[model samples]
Target: MATKKTQILILPYPIQGHINPMLQFAKRLASKSRHLILTLLLPTSHARSISSHIGSINVQPISDGADQQGQQFQTAETYLQQFQRAVPGSLDDLIRLERGHDQPQPTILIYDSFFPWALDVAHSNGLAAAPFFTQTCSVSSVYFLFKEGRLSDEMELPHGIPRLEQRDLPSFIQDKENSAHLLELLVDQFSNLDEADYVFFNTFDKLENQMVEWMARQWQVLTVGPTIPSMYLDKCVKDDRSYGLNLFKPNRESCRDWLCERRASSVIYVSFGSMAILKQEQIEEIAKCLENLQTRFIWVVRETEMAKLPSEFVEWNLSSGLGLVVTWCNQLDILAHETVGCFVTHCGWNSVLEALCLGVPMVGVPNWSDQPTNAKFVEDVWKVGVRAKEDEDGIVKSMVLEKCVRAVLEGEKGEVVRRNAGKIKRWALEAVQLGGSSDNNIAKFVTGLALKD
Candidate 1:
């Protein structure tokens, strides 16, 4: 008799940052073993956006209640509530449907850590569960401590981790009064983690060795990432150039053309990611900073944020032939481009990993959530970039931004920064290559799953 094949269901929270990393991980799993079948489970609303482009991977679109009712009018909080309420039932139906078809029954469910409720669904359905954490191990460690109420005044910092002042913690923890909802969501990630069969972090052993080791002592933890596409790292997987999902259309041709005209390491790339909303004053400050630098640049100002730009900033900057403003562009392409020198970013984990992988120095203008902690590391721990200091009013002044950018682009410090960036890039490359730490972990995971089957 033939052996029963193993089917693994991978689910991400319905957002660009969450979906991209998990999707990349699914690709890695698929590439690692033919014995395992991979299925990406996305909310019906988000799946519609990238269903066509996610080639080769099976996507199972499960309803999120709000989608069936018309998501156009739902608030973020309401949408999440509905998703939590609706996904369990949708997941039950999906599992049953898959079994009824020619496909093998899903034996394992890999879910985003943000939704601990998925663990319950997995156990009740007789499937093993693993939680994939999208944040850095450092940030995740903080959340873990907070969840266990160990972040008190007397709590000692982990040995390998940096000392985190209150200001360096995720915004939700630092300002619980204003971010109670998000704090609740973050802390809830650890509620049922003890019951999970395994836990995965989107980081590599070399990058966070001490913390990864510490976390493993508590759970069946695995470090299986820097989960970007293969083409950018080791090129192990054929034609794997992108995460294969773009919620917003990218200005691919225009971005390429503009960057092509610039000299190597002469352009500044600016993007705040898909979700961060900069205040009008902050936007204007960044505009002034770019003008003061007087260098070739590409800025991604999403359409919703266009109104926040200072009047005539784009038109005048474009007329001067110093800047090109687009709604969105392929960030990896830009970061990997020879013309790009420094990345001004919101310090999102996805962007941070991409920059580290590409060896691009950064100027972090972190806005909220885990960004503050990420920025802290980018400047202090990694030594690959500088984080702009915000004034008392919490806006990075144009002068401060200019200094940070200049620090990364010129002078003796720039040389040191570039060296660190290059070193980190090599580590990232090795982490995903054949026989590397992440690759080994991925292979081990597949082996375990196949053995269980």
Candidate 2:
């Protein structure tokens, strides 16, 4: 007779950027082992979006105090407080209920690093805990150093990591005074990490070998990512084209038609991920930059953000036949398109990985969080893209944005960026394929669990 399967539970912070990567990981874990049962536990608000698209992995809704309120919390701090207060009780109840069921009880708790409290819940219930980090290892290293009080005033970083000035640090640390709550949240990720069985980051080994090596010295670090759907990478997982969850329903058909009409490597694609709310002035500057380029472009201006765009910009673009200003679209689809040349992005980790995995060069206009650090690596370390410089007032002017885009899309610098992008893209693909670095790491995790069982 076959032995019982190991039951695993995953909990991600309830946001698009966080949920998608962790969900993809759940999918991959399920594919790797028949002896593992994976369940994704999301807050009620986020779990409502779960549907047929996510196969095999069970999705369960837990309370975050939003079910009764029937709306989002007004502030990040408030949301965190409520989620922390509510989720632990719900998780304990769920684990108890599962223990009474006929199936295997959850043996592992894979949680977002943001909620160190979950590790406590796991230990209380006799489960091994793993923390999933959705950011690059470089950014994580800075936070770890800061948390340990080892980061120096002069920014003397670890050996394998590049030296960074204050500005190159994650924005939360750079403006710690104004962003106290957020800075605390990020640094707190390391507080209970030592107790975790495994620490996972959504980055490949080749992309940050030194940083990953530095991080591994302290924890069971594993790099099992790109974490994008397999169809975009190795195609080993059948028909896995989408991330299976989106906060916004994309205008897929229109976006695909528009890109198909453009010439090869001739269109500019622009998007800032879900949460970034650019100031009206910054939006106008970006509008001006796109207008100045006079090339085919597709811009994703979320419905809420559309009001900040220059009045009649959409109408003007439509009439000029030079751009498509969409509310939201399948970003991976856009990046994978041959007509797309460069990505103008907010440099969110997920967006950066998608662009890198798809071999698209970028002009990074990072706004906040880990974006600035990711942008720095894009230009200085990866050499696969250029970061658009901002003016004294901390805004990227139209001319500066135009010049950055031009450098990535034309001339010798463009060639170098594209070539580097192509080279890294190949590495990204290899990392996810069978016997590749990331794949091996994933296999190790599965095998380790089996050996323990």
Assess each prediction's global lDDT (C-alpha) against the native. 0.89, 0.90
Question: How does candidate 2 fare on TM-score?
Answer: 0.97
lDDT per residue, candidate 1, 1-453, as tens digits? 877778899989988999889989988988877767788988887777656437667887888876778857446777787888899999888877776888788999999998898889888889999999999888998988887778876668785667887778899998999888889999999898899999999999888888888988988999989999888999988778898887889999999988998899999999999998899999999999998999888999999999998877777785798999999999999999999999999999999999999999999998899999999989898899998989888999999999999999999999999999999999999999999999999999988988887
RMSD of each candidate? Answer: 1.4, 1.4
Q: Estimate each model's TM-score.
A: 0.97, 0.97
Q: Ten-residue segment with the worst summed lDDT in candidate 2? A: 47-56
Candidate 2: segments with Cα more than 4 A from true spot: 69-72, 153-155
Candidate 1 lDDT trough over 10 residues, lowest sum: 47-56
